[model samples]
Target: MYSSIYTESKEMYDELKEWRRELHKTPELGLELPQTVSFVKNKLTELGIPFETKVNGNCIVGYLGSGERCLLLRADMDGLPMFEESQLSYASQNGNMHACGHDIHTTALLGAAKLLKKHEQDLKGKIKLLFQPGEETFEGARAVIKEGILENPKVDAAFAVHVASTLPVKTIAYGTLTATSVFGFKITITGKGTHGAMPQNGIDPINVGVTIYQALQELIARECAPSKEVSLTIGQFNSGTMNNVIPETAVLQGTLRTFDSETKQYLITRIKEIVKNISKAFRAESKIEVLTDIPVLCCDEKRNEEIVKALNLMNAELKIISGLHTTGSDDFAVYANEVPASYFMIGAKENSNTIYAHHNPKVCFNEQVLPIAAAVYACTALDWK
Candidate 1:
């Protein structure tokens, strides 16, 4: 099982963990990952692996084996824009940090690439190593797709692994479908500026903003079904600078998340109606715009079952979770739309009490999961077809 694979390549696995720690120390954000890109490219070069860099500026793609059946393995190369708080010796140098465990992801994929290269002659098909950037902002996967990563090799099936804090270490959580869809909206209300002391001189956008916010709550409560998972949160708001002066314009930004397409559309339409009606009531003009849209992630059940069987054969503890309709979203859905895709969770928590959630400054992953994850990546790819 997995132990044989680990014992056969113990040295390589240890090296991968070291690389992961190093990456954790020097983290980069978004598509601007020069150091990380160079590190990956140099390692590939030393191993005599062929790769293409900067497909979308910092996104790297490496190919191994030459068989007809091809599989794609992806890892996010970007870090979050947060300060480090961990006391590890290899703490982040700059303000940025690997709070989301992208470092571990990159290292695991690299390890898989190396091991797969050693067994290239035995491989039944080609393997595409995808080192993506800007996953924190959900832009990297789309950027890689735009660069033709899937077109050149033509991915038949794809797999991506993410380390989880909630799951126990060395355990695997496989979901048939992942609930992650995020939609952003910006609302601007225009009104006349006037002094607070004025009794009835001009329309106040602050009052209109408050009314709109309250109405938004009512819209969700009355319109959306409680059974359907949905969330709408206003994350940012801006208005007047002084207490006495009423600002002429007020801006509000928020995000909407849902697993149902019809519910998503209904929420968007209702949002527009609420903004319009609330503005009209206060004699103000309002405009609403959708900044971004991420579709819900749906997995191919057959492919997922295949992956689960493979991992179980590897002696990895398995758990089948009833897919949840969640508020968080991922761009991985974009790739799933085109092909059979499986997104698996690798446990990184040392224990229940010590685990920290993603995007938190104090978040850190158990590095030991790197080798297990790497092995899973290779085994899953080999299991395909």
Candidate 2:
């Protein structure tokens, strides 16, 4: 039933692999993706798809078909700030890496654009291709939304796919509750600096920071219900610069993840209270600020069911796995919140050896999954009612 889609996607496999590797080699970070944008623009131009570049960020929206009703397929174009350790021939020489598989997502969307263009005459409605930037930091989807990517013809639904290294290649994972929402925070503890030996003369902000960090553990452990999934992780702690000198300030950077909005608010309130009270107890001053907030990703049940049914009718050899969810957060949640959206996970695990998790320095995945993802994107756009 999906033979033509496979053949077209497979025909572009070599090209898709090259695109992914090139993107992987020259990974860009955040919204300012000049090289990456240029590459995608060149590809879009070659495919003859007309696109408009957003003025705010490096967001590119391309158009295909001439119908009225529309569907959108999005692919993130930015890489993480971490260094690459994949050791592939095309490994990034720069510090940045596509550890989150945005490279594959971009390449797959490019291939999908190619496939969809090949069958444009058969498409009943229009398809919008969004190549967005800065999913790692700022919510690029929000930027895309602000720029009105969902307008013009007006998209009826939106869909995107993320690559997972742990799942075997050719497996499609779906979930009702797709991904957890996150709140990233930076807390600073301030106190007077003095000689390291004269502990009694000045307040110790590091000690206060430690106390606040310890108290934060109870936010999820004791405060949140046992059945609820909430995680509080402190990723960075910075304090004294020298061994002997007491630092005047200590900064703690962390993220809070949860599926419940009320729980998210509770965690933030408790964190502020804990930091303030803990610092006051130690004769220190403190400040807590939210750096980023990503809403939980929830799929439209009806749209997801329809997409699953469409996938089942396809002839692709991939395994279709449903009812899957992840603790990780995605800025795509921004779009899912705004419109009827369905986000799926594509398995890219190549071997049974060592599966590296996403955002890891040595993260890697099977390139063969690229065509499958592209096909799914193209078919979803082509077959959706």
Candidate 3:
């Protein structure tokens, strides 16, 4: 039953690897991905697939088949700002890195597109391919929606696959709440600057920044329920420009993650209050801003069951991982929030080499999982009821 799926996917395995390598060599960042966009466009054109560029985004959407029911499959096309140290022959010479395996995501979707286009006549419904950018900045999916990528035919359901670093190849992992909702915030504290010799003359924004940080931690510890999960991290703190001179302003940036919506809102509300009160006590004026707030990605139970059944036909293991949720966030939440959506993780761990986590300079991915992911995406789109 699954012979044809694997055979077709295997045929594109070489092309998929080449695409992944080429993309790995030239990783682009944020909303503007000129080279990445061009590469994907050329491939779509070569496949004789009809597509539209910039559904008001720095991305492209390809369409195949015709029917009342439409399904959207998404692939994020952005790279992190970190430098690569993997030292592979195809390793990026440029500073940017595809440390999160987005290159694999893009290529797998392309592979599935090729497969689906060849069998388009057999398909009963329409398939919309969303090649999105700026996922790293958590703005791509929202931008795709803003540009109306889900309209015209109006998507009924959606699907996406993210690569997993630790799970072994060919393993499929998913859950009800796959990931936590996250909010990125920045707090700026302003105070009087003074020479180090005259400490009393300065309001000391650095001291205020540290106090706020500690207070934020306490909010997590004391206010949050012991059974619930929430994380608050201060990733960046910038203050003094010199040893003797106290900087007039201190900037604090961090992230908040929670699994429940009420907890998420409560944390955000408390965070603002904590920062405001702490700064006021230190006699410093402060402002807090939320850079981005991505909702928790919840898989549609019906859609997830359909995907799991479809994948099982290809002889894949569908693992319902419990209490293994990730703190990291994805803008795919934006799409899932709008439609019946399901996102799965494809295990790509190659045990021989040292495993480096995502966003690390030395991160590596198992290319062998490329065809598996392609097959799963194609089969899920094709076999869904």
The most accurate candidate by TM-score is 2
- At residue 96, candidate 2 shows an lDDT of 92
lDDT of 2 at 231: 91
Best by lDDT: 2
The lDDT values for all models are: 0.81, 0.88, 0.87
Clashes of 1: 1
lDDT of 2 by residue, 1-385 (tens): 3567877888888999999999989999888999999999999999999999984638889998877688889999999888888888899988899998999999999999998888888787888899999899856877778878878988888999999998888789998898999899999889999999998999988899888888898777889997788999999999998888888999999999999999899888889889888888899998888889989999999998888777766654668887877789889898888889999998899675777899889889899898989989988888876
Model 1 Cα lDDT, one tens digit per residue, 1-385: 4445554445576698789988888899877998999999988898789988755459888988886778888888888888899777889979999988889999998888877777677677888898988877777777788878788778998889888765677777656558657788999999998888993888888888888888887877888889887888997889999988888999998888888889889889889988998899889999998877878888788988887777677664544353533455667788888889888877788643776788888877887788888888877766766
Model 1 spans with C-alpha error above 4 angstroms: 1-3, 8-13, 54-56, 196-202, 316-326, 352-354
Candidate order (lDDT)? 2, 3, 1
Give the per-residue lDDT digits (tens) of candidate 3, residues 286-323.
99988889999998987787777777776645443433
TM-score per candidate: 0.91, 0.97, 0.96
User: Which residue window of length 10 is worst by lDDT in model 3?
Assistant: 315-324
Worst 10 residues of 2 by lDDT: 309-318
- Model 2, runs deviating above 4 Å: 55-57
lDDT agreement of model 3 with the native = 0.87
Off by over 4 Å in 3: 55-57, 316-324
